[model samples]
Target: MTLDPKEPVLRVVPGPTDINANGHIFGGWVLSQMDIAAGIVASRRANGSVATVAIDTMEFLAPIHLRDVISVYAQVERVGRTSMGIRIEVVASRDRGREEVKVTSGLFTFVAIDADAKPRPVDAPE
Candidate 1:
């Protein structure tokens, strides 16, 4: 799916299991959400299976509350012969809050893989 910065790939409330001891959403949970969102973009662009190669410049900007609605946005940043880069941003909206705040952002790298799990070339943009 084509994910726009204005749109989110996943939206849901954070449950107790998603929280940390600090009374806020777990950082790992947030990163996992971002990874899923990025995977969608990568898979669609690659037209095949892909594996996460790396994540760069990941930053958590704000705390997410338990009842907050999390939105994960992803977009393709670039594509290489066998790798693609995606930028993902996680935003949160609380019931009592007036607006959504950006909770996290990162760059994800994925490499296209064939049926045999070997690296495969990704199609070039025309």
Candidate 2:
């Protein structure tokens, strides 16, 4: 899937509270951002609420430093009757935006749910 930096699903800077003892951002924090971004994309496609069912794969390529701007990009890679597999990529821009690094990436699965919270068809008419 093509990820456009010009159109990130979410973008924000890491805070001091989000840092680890190693002077890098916490993995959990990054994962949370990925999930939020993936949820937005999945919900838009589903035209309703979607829950994260699984993280099929994840990779931590580099550490994210404080003061770096984190940009998350996500796209629906595949969709089933009720579930969608979204591919998420995170990039960190540092050195006043001169340098960009791919820090984390993962494939997360989300299932659309109805008002009663039961799984619903993703293609159902809204």
Candidate 3:
């Protein structure tokens, strides 16, 4: 099941290179997708540059298979002075969208940055 009902931040399809020798998609590939989705949400919220600070938590619930369409969902869970906690979830749609399974969930921290790559307030004006 998808973690959220709203639209996904990113949808991606895995290629042959993404598959592992075990015939399942690589966990690192799924993690990259989650990070990308979280970065997108964090950047939009910060309204400027942002950098990933940390991954607070992560859980891999199901194995992703080849030909599964990955839907990454992310949102701002909390906003700090210079950082935001992004909640990210990944769902894999299989069998041509007939079945969907929650593949992974994670929480990431992102800090807003200025031109110098220093921390900046999240509410800073445009």
Say which candidate scores most in lDDT. 2
- TM-scores of all models? 0.91, 0.94, 0.94
Sort order, lDDT high to low: 2, 3, 1
lDDT of 1 by residue, 1-118 (tens): 4556677878867789888889998888888888998998899899879999999779989999998888888889998899999999888887766788988999999999888888
Considering summed lDDT, which 10 consecutive residues are worst modelled in model 3? Answer: 1-10
74-109, model 2: which lDDT tens digit per residue? Answer: 999999999999999999999999999999999999
Model 2 vs. true fold: TM: 0.94
Error of 3 at 102 (Å): 0.4
Give the per-residue lDDT digits (tens) of candidate 3, residues 1-126.
Answer: 333538998999999999999999999999889999999888888988999989999999999998899999898899999999999989999999999999999999999999999999999943
Q: Is candidate 1 or candidate 3 better by lDDT?
A: 3
**Candidate 3 ranges beyond 4 A from true positions:** 1-5
Per TM-score, the best of the predicted structures is 2
TM-score of 3: 0.94
Question: Candidate 1 at 83: error in angstroms?
Answer: 0.4
User: Please, what is the whole-model Cα lDDT of each candidate in the order they appear?
Assistant: 0.86, 0.93, 0.91
